[model samples]
Target: MPLGTLDRDPPPFFRQGPSALSKLAVCSALAFFLMVADARFKVMQPLRVVLATVLYPAQWLAMRPVLVFQHASQYFSSLTAAQTAQQEVLRKHSLQSQRANQVEQLSLENERLRKALGLRERLQSPSVAAQVIYDAADPYSRKVIIDKGMADKIALGSPVLDESGVLGQVTRVYPLVSEVTLITDRDHAIPVLNTRTGARGVAFGDVSLHVDAMELRFMAANADVAEGDLLTTSGVDGVYPPGLPVARIEKIERRVDAVFARIYCVPLAMVAGAGHVLVLEPTNAQIPARPAADVPAVVPRRGASR
Candidate 1:
């Protein structure tokens, strides 16, 4: 057949139903209609169920990496938060402990001060309330330093007392502070009277005992001294006032061959731990001055001179 005579369109057996643009418009309209029907009336619900069932395993597999990453992130963040919380708790606990100790110390100090004030009121002699600053630096002697000194009218030989009993005596006085020699000092000696027997003796600080103590020296082996006897200041020593507790007899050693017995005594005052004290004027200050001897006229001698 001649070229001009051939048919311009394809035969019916090989031809499509519509043009591409036409097919695209028709398919888009059908998809829109199906979506609207599914939304409004459940038109494609059965088909959606079948398709979802076929894709369920693949969807689960595809999301595994994302789920793992999210879980790991959450776990690390929680661990960090736990560690931070632990540190905070520790810090707060330590602070609470320190504050508790401070409160306890203050309470103890307050109690001591209150007792000192009460004792001050009961005292018949003039006294000054003073704080014990620290122990004296001398390792060979038992002494303490007080905040009150010459400036506070604290004089040498003044009696120092705590809430319990006589503690020490003012030995050295400075402008702002004073040094008190404890009764337990090795060189210190005091006259004490037994409250039980009314026996008087001299007690010297015992150097043999490891702890602070005194011993009644030069007592007869048969003396009426006993353990647990309370010893008080005799006031005849011209230092501490009479009736002030000095020590308690702890042990008595009587050697058969020895002429005198040794009686060990423990001081009644807080010798090692006193924080507050009262300084009192010496007992001698209160005693009357000794009267001067009257000059007797030598009448016979005068007559001889005339």
Candidate 2:
């Protein structure tokens, strides 16, 4: 027989325990008794407390990295949320500001239109209403373009006006638009009458001041002109209507050696950024020619010199 088939047993002298089944039964009974004793008499309570106290430091140390990672994640999340909220608030504030500005601009525009309409109605002139298209291309001259042109009966030398006074006169007329020369242009002049002292003078546009101003040229240095005086069209020029507003006396300067007073006036009309205006028919156009019998002599034409 093989050696593996023989019984493997310890010598009696060396044997010191019972069979495996008996040993298992004895261990189970001792475990059950210990459990009962712990439950009823609290025998292991002190040992458990001592073990927890001893292991607390190790437990805290083992969880340190997890706690740190959780806290970091929460901090980053909170920062991101705050930034997003701030951006949203800024966007809303900007939108409101733009809306408020638009509303204010619209209100001002509407007020101007209303005043212009009232002025137009009060004047009994044959006029055509037109809107400003844009400013003229000339940088050195104060001029603007209107939407009306020859097609709309806008003629040369026609007076244009805004709410307050004569803004300008139509200078160039195209098929669909017309160019207006403002009263502030250097080449423009208007005959004005002072309402206070009943004085007549010619107001020429002044470019030397670099401001939108006009000067009463050729007036005596000690003239009766005063500040705050109102100037209106004298109706003698056969262009602007009588009693129409032109400008107001803003400043007057009299020099010892000068022959004329350096009087500056501010135009009553909205010369800059005018939206709506009126184009009036030229006053000379409406006047009839003199009778042929009243002519002193009929001058021969230059081409008839042959």
TM-score of each: 0.83, 0.76
- Badly placed stretches (over 4 Å) of model 1 are 1-17, 288-306
> Candidate 2, residue 199: CA error in Å?
2.6
Using TM-score as the measure, the top candidate is 1
Candidate 2: worst 10 consecutive residues by lDDT? 290-299
**Candidate 2, residues 1-306: lDDT per residue as tens digits?**
999998789778777779889999999999999899999999989999999999999999999999999999999999999999999999999999999999998898788889888888887678998999899887999999999998998889999998889998999999999999999999999999999999999998887775788888889998999999999999899998889999999989999999998999999998887888999998998889877786487779988965
lDDT of 1 by residue, 243-296 (tens): 988999999999999999978999999998999899999978888999999998
Clashing pairs in 1: none
- Cα misplacement distance, residue 251 of candidate 2 (Å): 2.6
Q: For each candidate, C-alpha RMSD in Å?
A: 4.6, 7.0
Give stretches of model 2 more than 4 Å off. 1-53, 150-152, 255-259, 285-306
